[model samples]
Target: MTKTAIIAGTGVLPGILADRLDETNTPYVIAELEGFAMENPKGRPVERFIVERLALLFDRFDDLGVEQVIFAGAVSRPAIDPERIDPKTATLLPVLLPAFQQGDDALLRAVIALFEDAGFSVVGVDSVAPELVPGEGVLTTAQPSQDDKADADRAAKVVAGIGALDVGQGAVVAQGLCLAIETLPGTAAMLRWVAEVAKTCRANPNGAKGVFFKAPKPGQERRIDLPAIGPDTVVQADAADLAGIVIEAGGVMLLDPEATIAEANSRGLFIWARTP
Candidate 1:
């Protein structure tokens, strides 16, 4: 059996993945980032690593017989300390530094390449937990009005436009008017900003507030960093006074699908796993 190394960041996802791996008796180890700690480690075997010394992590993985790697949860860019950069990581700085100047997609692709070059296969979350990616449909009891559907369509295009520049994975559109685009601050912060804005603005003529749409960037490396939402997202959207939440079916991960749907239903907000 190939042992897998899960590079966990901050969020419930790493714990959720750990739980699934446990249920199947799969051999795995959780490698926690230095600053971005896993929300719930579930008492699994864990190792800590810093980005500046990845060579040491590779060596540790070798000792643990880890042949595959997967990334779970969210991570902010770490400020590198030049003094801590190991000789091996230093050799890759030329590539990495330039990627760091680029968008997140570029940086992640570069990171993935390093692991691949070290002879490990990188896997996507969907491959390990297909159920987390909900299929196309309105998941909540509340349905999207025709206006909401149109807003979703517009939001999808806006997300794609920003994604092409490696900007973000989410957007808010109401009655074909672009309300906001998510940037590095992330979905929760973006939604909070939208809520603040809603306090002063009137609803669209059609009476639909807006749609919060999320999806992975076009041409993004889906093996890691896919857009995700959970119960909290539902609460945030409701607070923003949005009509519904729209996620690209098969692209966005639904953390705790049951709770997310339940929250949306209770808030009378629709959760549409849209097809595209």
Candidate 2:
């Protein structure tokens, strides 16, 4: 039977996408990244190397008849250690230097080329989770007020600008001001920052509450590391006592939409999709 595979980088995309394929009756395999800057579960099948080591991943793909591969997860750019690249990947070093030395975007594009050369078509996580793409409308019981929308707009611009510079794609906003942006510490930490700030705002009585906006970094590769939100985001927002959430329509992925939406509705959090 034809097969598919997931080249998991970080976060929950690898396993989530794999499960989606399974539901479609499509068999799949996962090649988790090893020794990269991100977390990896013990006993997972991971190969330690750079993008070029994908050549070997294709060997495994061929064995499973995996004609398509989805590159998912959250491996940060700085996590790659040059000394860890295997011999085959080492040889491709010269060709990759210009891009690798430049930025993660260029490096990922190079990796895409390697996979293409090996006869496997690379796609995004959206292929398996189309419903995860939010539409233009209120997605929760509550609605974003005009002021909240303004804050979300400002946060979106800031987050997208930061994404363009490869910083990150999420920002917290309240009353047209930015509270925090997702950095090396990750989104959860950033939300916590907003929560802290929200407490101060609430105490002031004249201040406004906060919300989070997650958008794609401008020019970020859609095939890899698309911004994702799930039930955890709602839980986090509730803990932060934030007012609502906004995400770019179709730009970010909802890891588990039904559960996430249900959680947001249950928590009285408003969710909207902004069009830009």
RMSD of each: 1.5, 3.3
Report the C-alpha lDDT of model 2 over 125-204, residue by residue, as the tens digit.
77777887877888888998877787887888889788888777898877777767888788888887766764565434
Off by over 4 Å in 1: 202-206
- Give Cα distance to truth, residue 78, candidate 1, Å: 0.9
lDDT of each: 0.89, 0.75
**lDDT score, candidate 2:** 0.75
For model 2, state the Cα shift of residue 275 in Å.
Answer: 1.6
Whose TM-score is greatest here?
1
Q: What tens-digit string does per-residue lDDT give for candidate 1 at 1-110?
A: 77889999998998898888887888999999998988873566679999899988998999989999999988988988999999988887887778878789999999
Ten-residue region with minimum lDDT total, candidate 1: 198-207
Which residue runs does candidate 2 get wrong by more than 4 Å? Answer: 35-52, 77-86, 198-204
